[model samples]
Target: MSTYEIALDSKAREVEWNNAKCDKYDYMISVFCGLSAGIIDAFFVGTPGKGRLGQWTDKTADNMVQKIANMLWTGDKRSSVDGRPKNAPDTLEKAISYLEQSFPVNYDARYGKDLINGNAISGMSPLNHHLLSLAHSPDIIGLLFSIIDQFTGKATFINNGKLIRLVPVKDARNNKVMYMQGTNFESKVFCGVCNWLGHLISDLCGSSSTRKVGKTGRGAGLPIPFYNLFLLMDLGKFDSNSFADIAVKIFEEGYDLRHGAAMAIPVLIEELSIKVIWALKQHCYAKKEWKDCIPSAKHADLRMMLLIGNATLCLVDGIDAAIRTGIKGGNPITFILHLNLVAWARLVMLVFRELKIRYGSIVDQAVGKYLAQIGLNDAYSLKQYYERMNAIDQKLDSVLRDFTFKVEDDYKVFIQSLNYTLNSSLRTPEQGRDVSVAIAKKEGVKSDRIFRSQEELRYWLGEKK
Candidate 1:
């Protein structure tokens, strides 16, 4: 049997790509020409099914819908992918219980943020839709979304062959995966992807540019943010509409319904419509809490990772807003965070947007170099930025050593790989769109078709020429 149908996945992905030129997405992974956003590296995609294993491998994608409805009937945790082990925690309470057991701390007290605690049971992959699984298990819900997001634009009808490819798990140890750093999926990525990102981050900022062009760097297996976020959106973190809003909106504060990479910016843009600039300034200066959250005399390195913790924390907070709003665009914090997103936080949004537009797509190779240029050209200071980043790198390594003791050997191995990734990715946050475009030509992708019509959605999404 084959199942294929169009269904909303996480809104975050829908929102992000909604404004993307349709030609880029539907045509082939390669046609992008780096005109849009993000690169495609099959190896960097996170674990298949994103913790939600779909059994409809025959392609009819429809098999899982009935199975979704029947989750409580048989309570099977096994994957349809050739006896890969039943991978879900089973039941909403059980999932939450796993989180509790994993973290061994109060969860709900943090206003539903316990899922992100690295040491908690909630760390079952820092996804927000965990609550969506409250009616079932996060694993089940994650699977349902995996089906929709993967098949949506690609599906022709219900129960089609597209279902067979809906979920593609990570190789886990491929060590050559790639991804973006300084974001949430940072620590959770595969080692291969980490190597690419780390190298990109470094080349973008580090002194070596010409020599590394034709050579491949070491592997770390980090997850790809471009694809990872796509999966997150499929699971309902953001929708096509939100993605559109993200493409257009700058950054203020509002009912942040949009998902994708623009969550923090759009909400701040709409909610703080009256005072967008002021609000940006505030969040920029908001105190980062890495020191507060993991306060301990463990090591100078562990405490050091908290250097960029403020920026990462800001992204997390904004993403949280996206999750709570159903990626639709409603919420009071949009009203509250209006007057305070200044300084680095505000700068981060603008810089991030520019980078995405300029060098974010597969066609952009100069992107990283552009970022390095920006860092070097900054009127304020690149020296401090470099120092902080170096310190943060050291700190990250220290913490990795400390936490590996608590998890399984597999997880420990995963963390061990983070050393290079952390060092490579923290190179710089800015890149030139030109540089990104240049480099995109070399790395292979699936196709060369980018839906040019989708560009219209960018205007609606706030992307202007």
Candidate 2:
């Protein structure tokens, strides 16, 4: 295994397990190895009794924030500055410099038979992913969110401020097709992830990086509230069934990654939920802001984390639709994996809460019966839930084993697409500089996918011009 995978394995091992420890390991490994392709595969294969909700499917939107953040660490050109490469984002100017270099400016000259050599950007569709799988294509590449691009010199910026990743693709083709590798192209998941991460101190290596480079806040042309800290509430402390619902509500109110690393919810609350809730109470959360600040208004990053986490809850409202409608043919596999992982995580928390709320006699009665008689009074519901959890957990382990690039091909495809788009060529040889971006935009999106519109593609690539 590579050093990166090993380190991730160790970290995964260290994390405590509630449902299935092994499966959790697989999840983490997949995150580092290939972005969870196995989960997607399994969902499409249709395990057992996987029910549907109604009309919607996984075609809506994919929250690839974690993957984007991870790419930042990989140093895509989107994270580089003019004078400062991603491999080194020391001073505030360096960070700012990197952002300016990536965000695409002139949309007019993009469309043509070939890319402008260096001007190609990727789209955010599965087609780019498909091409990334191609073996002998020079059009493949990878990208990074602004976080990791601290060392690479290419990352994107919003106007003159707000540094983040435009998209971390590895190739010119990916740039042309994938809409910068962003799912919510118009919504700004790129900047949101960057601004969200900015609220904390990630690479504390030294004086150069974002560790402390800026005028307290607002480095480069970055926004004033780009990294401001704000705390909302701790859901774990609440004693009501509405807590989760309330949490979801807060997420809808726009607490997205703009506010904190995570809300100081109880450890149990974090464990029960389906999504990964990064705790900010210890290492970085309490240390910096909450150390001596007031309870409600202390430590800005934590507040922002919570804000984002909370808002994310609301964003996931379409789960019911996805489950009900069933996944589309083009995206069936991926949607299944995403839905399962997300749903399982959410349900786990809800179940745990139910256990706590209906405690005492119910617990004693059920377990006592199970210990005494196999099927007497039958606390069958409890037994069933446990049994199902075990099965799912086991399945998670199996699915996770091959979810990444080394185990699967989709990951490599995505990586390759990324590489194809980020080349420093100001123009293309085979396809003429004008045609380069036209081809790139197409590379990111596949005509087969459900969401992308050809008109929008034309507008972005200047085909409309």
Candidate models: Cα lDDT each: 0.29, 0.32
In order of appearance, the predictions have TM-scores of 0.17, 0.23
- Root-mean-square deviation of every model: 31.0, 22.9
Candidate 2 residues 62-166, lDDT tens each?
Answer: 112223333444566443344335464434334433333333221112112222332333321211211111110111121222323322223332211222233
**Model number with the top lDDT:** 2
Candidate 1 residue-wise lDDT, 182-245, digit = tens: 3223343333233322222221111122112343321111121221222223222243434322
Q: Candidate 2: lDDT of 282? A: 34
28, model 2: CA deviation in Å? 46
- Measured with C-alpha atoms, the lDDT of residue 49 in candidate 1 is 20
